[model samples]
Target: MKSMRAMNVSQPRRIRIANGQGFWGDSVDAPVRLVEEGPLDYLTLDYLAEVTMSILQKQKRRDPARGYATDFVQLIDRILPSLRTKGIKVVANAGGVNPSACRQALVEVAEEHQARGLKIGTVTGDDILDRLEELIASGVGFENMDDGRPITDVLDRIVSANVYIDSFAIAEALARGADIVISGRTTDPGLVLSPLIAEYGWKQDQWSLLAAGTVGGHVVECGAQCTGGNFSRWWEVDGWDRLGYPVLEFAENGEFIVTKHDGTGGLVSVDTVSEQLLYEMGNPKAYLTPDCVVDFTSIQLAQDGKDRVRVSGIRGGEATGTFKVSIAYLEGYKATGQLTVSGPDAVAKAKVCADALWGRLERAGFTYEKTITELVGLDSCHGQIPGPPPDVHEVVLRVGVKDGDRAKVDRFGKELAPLVTSGPPGITGFAGGRPKATEVLGYWPSLIPKDRIVTHVDVEEVQ
Candidate 1:
């Protein structure tokens, strides 16, 4: 930890940070637009989801150098020249389960772009899948945070286990002159929070500043969410075609303004920012992070201007000694098949089709551990409410099955197409072939002692 005396710079230096991506499949053009459309000091991207690690782990098993987000490499190829010209830094968690592989890909992209003197930092050590047995022997239980089950129960089926690391390693990478930082399994807020820690030289004990930065990170972490993409009042928001991603104007006093680029789309009011604040939040009083536990209830929001909201009055407490661990395992196999049922009695015909499919499967001695049948137009979203089936022109009959036996699930797929010919009238939409059984991955959340995890940062310069 570097002391404030070593910083030796003027106080109250503000920076502009914008988030271009919210998740793995976010718009590919948003990141490039964020860089080219406006002035930005830092660009943060997030690419991992809870089940993303398992998917990436499977990819790495097939190919040694293929686990990270490939989109990030291509995005960098498009934006490297602008980033270098603008003197802008980038921080992202596109590393997935393979930071080294991601680093290599980024190096290749940089070389292809002919970008020189760029320091790419690779942050590692969040992965603990190989150390599970050793940690268990050393008295780490890895108990399920939800059901309190021991991890030994599913040890053989476990595919990925990563701890949610903090932002300090990223800050260290920046301090070491890294122009871009790549990390694995970092908390989404840490992507933005790390740059604040690095640029402001905030100490670990500054809970208020850390909490403020964490809130700032959370607001823009989802990209357009704070800028009215998923706001409850969608009708109130304008410019859906060109919605601007969220940007933060962070200051040294632990206050930041959330806004979008002038003349760009998307609305950034208190309501939109408030809606994003509660997204996936558990406890308002103690929003836990690796750096500190924030008091979200103590925070205040006000409209600073059009498409701008000011956030202030945040308080925080000390961080817990344990870090949350995301563990994914192979649950079983699942397959789904759907058919569009139309005409006089679409709902009734769909129901009959579902019943016939199940009866045929039972007669063939193909029983599954679980099965679901839904009439897409009727009750797929909010499971069948108390009401007569709405009279509709057409309804899609979707059926799925999950079981430990792959053969059974595959056989279940074979049953759906037969329904179109034999079950009910006016059944179509089977153009897409039978659904093949796919691996079903389950998530297990756990906790690990913070001391058990040690993160490393390596900064390499492009020649």
Candidate 2:
């Protein structure tokens, strides 16, 4: 196979890339369907969430070979043959806390299919849990970005720490002839942007082009979200069950169109695409990434026919000298329990049930660091919206507690089952059994100088 770097300098008029996953728990069949349903040059999968590193770390602690997203491996197992046969490549951040383990799994999958001559790349050096103390000793404070607290406050409690790497590393993997690039803690947009960089031979100083790719990536990063899954106007969308994942038809000049396969479900219009563009958006004028800083205000969107939106005129600036770091630590323990309240005055009955549950816990010497009681249907969210709430037939009484004490959280769980028989009539819906206390992981976002972190890319061919 020809190396990605060795491809002709004269690029194609257009290339098609699609993202079939938004996060780790998104539909399992989406990526497989994306490969089989339509033509694509590259398929990207995003499996890491903000707190996903901690979860994968816990798994790694339990089993050495089990830190990556297993779902991705399964998906690859199902679609590897199609990907190779159709001349499609894959780029994904499903490596979680361990890209090496993920690459090993993929190699095994390739071997299982007796598939040879396939190159798999693993991007590493993002994880910094082991280097936290060393970095702190070297004057890297690792202060909490939100509150400006020093790392010494919870230094020992840190579980996972990873810096967000850039698309350049992924592009390098492709340049080395990697058919599939699995990365650790890559920025969501990097997955889509890397392909454009590799295909178009985009230069590092090309801020405008980089920004354009980043904006395009942000639009389709969440799979079908931009394709009408989370649109504001739900009544206009159709084919919910088979909604098409988003596709980016890219030009060498940094222009692109957001669309999906024909005959597939979902809508990809200006509104749907616009909704996704605003997702997780901070400042409309400046969106930061490892490669460049994008000006969202400069972006132009045009309706380019049915199920297609042309995106252009994106402007960007230089990236910061620092990289954002995601750290997770042991926060405490928390457990939540809910019960249904029916019949007349259901809202009143639900509120009463919440109070009773907390009162019982308080009386039992089970004080917590914090506690919350919510009449779910009434005001769990938005907290009692202005004006009178209409009468409801039923409401769910949900209560949760968080504390440093595990025993206290465990005892809180015991108090919920008693509510079914002891407090308020019409209490039910505990068929899944008692709620158990689970460890709460707290997020700590910080920044590290770009010079302090080094990314390594290793590509190995399947034997």
Candidate 3:
């Protein structure tokens, strides 16, 4: 048994982590390809973002089990046979707003693959919404990190409040006979890190070791971000459509080989890995998490071969008591439209374009918290951001405003479509049936004590 699992008895072995899904709407083919393509000990998918929590919360309110990523359950049913055949485990934050419900859904999927039963695990307790009042009364001010105001200032408008938990809980679930681990609002890197811990049985205080694993997780958590999907030099990348999903071939000693599936597309150049290293990273020297503070610079990525990069040499530090806070508020609805100006004086034509649209709206009694009009293809970007004004070929007259009045927003939406038929000749990219009015959900930030919440792990049979 030990010989078959060389990683278990010795100096540790490479454990591969494949990030199949980048965000909620990413391709299902990604994960399917990853599993069929190579040997992966753990498969990871991260589906939650700050604003995503609000969206999921709204769905949960409508139906108890409906909020979690339904696609994940569907994906499970498709991949369960492949998973058992390959002996590959999966970890994901697709539980979104409801971990227990997602767990239940996975068990149903497992039951369908009756040849081999599957044990699904869920990690809860990050949510702190119900404890808001008691936490505030205890002199713990969960103030808005941005505005510094107390929680009461926007008490009624709050939607979802969850802490970014460490990956150790995920590791624990895997240790406790769980074939799959589902969670809500875990750190993006946690999905990857937990698998490393589960495979190696790393203790909690293995700070330097855990930090190294965390760095690897960050690299692959966004699917193709490190795999050349979002690279700025898209031209430089060889094959994007077949671009390989990322994999972290982890080792028990906190080192790993960073590579993609063999014979798959995508390049693992040093520059590509470097770009992913910088995403959502605050302090490279101290990339803080509930697990440990990761020192990204100490890490090194060496090109081992084609589609393979060796990742090693990371350091770690202590973690802070507080976790990152995510809060949201109501931003109301906004409507925006753009028109191209392409006459002799395109800039002048652009301003004329703006005036004509707003002139009528103003006459119709339209006022909002803000109104903006800009010319694209010319001076849209960096427009009075730091300074202003660059004269060029054509300007796109972009106008937008937000207000409590839904009618005003509806009117603005109606105004954009007419501009295409009546305004400039070069307008495009608007294939959708007209830009409909949509309400934008705002975000808020605050903190809660670690003890204020508790995480529960539950398992059940599928009906």
Q: What is the C-alpha lDDT of each candidate?
A: 0.92, 0.90, 0.79
Query: Which segments of candidate 1 are over 4 A away from where they belong?
Result: 1-12, 385-389
Q: Which 10-residue window of candidate 1 scores lowest in summed lDDT?
A: 1-10
Candidate closer to the true structure by lDDT (higher is better), 1 or 3? 1
- TM-score quality measure for candidate 2: 0.96
How do the residues 171-251 of candidate 2 rate in per-residue lDDT, one tens digit apiece? 999988999999989999989999999889999999999999898889878889999998999999999999999999999
**Best lDDT among the predictions, by candidate number:** 1
Clash tally, candidates in order: 0, 0, 5
Q: TM-scores, in order shown?
A: 0.96, 0.96, 0.90
Cα lDDT of model 1 by residue, 1-463, tens digit:
3667456454456689999999999999999989988889999999999889999988999999998999999999899999999999999999999999999999999998888888999999998888999999999998899999988889999999999998999999999999999999999999988999999998999999999999999998889999989888899889898999988999988899999887678899999999999999998999999999999998899998799899999998898999999999999999998999997899999999988999988999988899999989988999878988678999999899999999999999888888878977899999778899999998999999899999999999998
Please identify which of the two predictions, 1 or 2, would achieve the higher lDDT against the true structure.
1
How well is each residue in 325-429 modelled by candidate 3, as lDDT tens digits?
A: 676666678778665566567777667657777887778877677788877776567545554555577666778888777777877777666656666565544
Model 2, position 30: C-alpha lDDT score: 85
